[model samples]
Target: MIKKALKTAFPYSIPILTGFLFLGISYGIYMRALGFSAAYPIFMSMLIFAGSMEFVTASMLLGGFNPIGAALLTLMVNARHIFYGITMVSKYKNVGKKKWYLIFGMCDESFSINCSVEVPEGVDKGWFYFWVTLLNQSYWVLGATCGALLGSLVTFDSKGLEFVMTALFVVIFLDNWLKEKNYFSSLLGLGISLVCLVVFGAEKFLVPAMCMIFIVLSLARPHPEKEVA
Candidate 1:
């Protein structure tokens, strides 16, 4: 079952594999440049699993150690997962115990493929989702470990590489926008987030933006259905 799932799921994950490995490596190198050990990235990639938040946490670790502040920041950065969970709850209902890991490993890319793709007749949907999650994480961990270890030996400057994550997200948003004709939700999210960021400042904008998104989306939910009909 594992082998079959792996074979079936791998092709779907290649783009993520490429992107995650590059971003993961860049993340590790950033930490190393900050005087952290390779184990830091490895453990973080394995445990935290949120790419953007992990990068933000690295900077946070260097500054201060306020547990309350950290907790709030984590929630703000990962608030979108609330929406992802709502969308995925029904899809994940019958996956048995694997649902826990599926939820744990539910990064954006993994969620995209699992939620949208239909499994082949012979493939186990649960195992296919599991492999997608597992393989994506493995790429991240591997890349992070390698980059951290290689950082010390490399000679080039890697200053400003954190933009890679931002660029990656832009690419993802654009991809989804291009794939679907109805982009009201995407446009709404982008417009609201940008306006909030401008008004509230980057550090303080995420929570407000998320709140606004939830409220607006909730109100507009029925409109989209009506438009489709």
Candidate 2:
């Protein structure tokens, strides 16, 4: 099982590793710029393990976002996972105790790649997915730690580095949208997020956007007439 999971997880190390290296450096840069030491992200990544959230964490910590506000923002930004997790219910049938870790670690990128791939009938899909999650996280930790170490020395404008993370999401969103037969649902997400962001700002917008997304997705099912045609 270990061997199989390692093999399956190897291919994923490339993308995951790339993200960790770049995003880790970005986080380190942001943290240092905010008057924090390099060890901050290293510790945070181990505990938090959420990339985008970690970026927000640096600012939140410095500005005193508070636990309640931080928790709310975390829930809002990551609310899409509730839907992502539903798809895994049946897929992880034989996983048992491992299900807990799986659910806990499931990220947007990990879920997308795992669900899209077909793990042969005899292979342990659970194990394969598990390693992918593990490796992805390892990359993040490595990137953050390494970046923080480097950030202490390298002195350049980190102002634009933060945008790299946002750019990554844009790329992922576009790639996913391109694969969808009808991206109308995705468009709805974009529109809803924008509106909520404008009205509620970052801290308060996540929950509203997430609720709106769920409502839209639930009601936006294809019409019976369209389905028949």
How displaced is residue 77 in candidate 1, in Å? 1.0
Best by TM-score: 1
Best by lDDT: 1
Please provide, for model 1 over 1-229, each residue's C-alpha lDDT reduced to its tens digit, 9 standing for 90 to 100.
8789889999988877777877888889999889888889989999999988999899999997899999988988898788789988888878789889999999977887787677898988889999999998898898898889885675555566545455656766777788888989999989999999999998788789889998998887776656766
The local lDDT score (0 to 100) that residue 57 gets in candidate 2 is 77
TM-score of each: 0.80, 0.74
Following a full C-alpha superposition, what root-mean-square deviation does model 1 have from the true structure? Answer: 3.7
Q: Could you tally the backbone clashes for each prediction?
A: 0, 0
lDDT of each: 0.85, 0.76
At residue 40, candidate 1 shows an lDDT of 94
Residue 131 error, candidate 1, Å: 0.9
| Backbone clash pairs in model 2 (N, Cα, C under 3 Å; residues 3+ apart or in different chains), count | 0
Residue-level lDDT tens digits of model 2 in 145-202? 7777786676555455545445656766788787899888879989999999999997
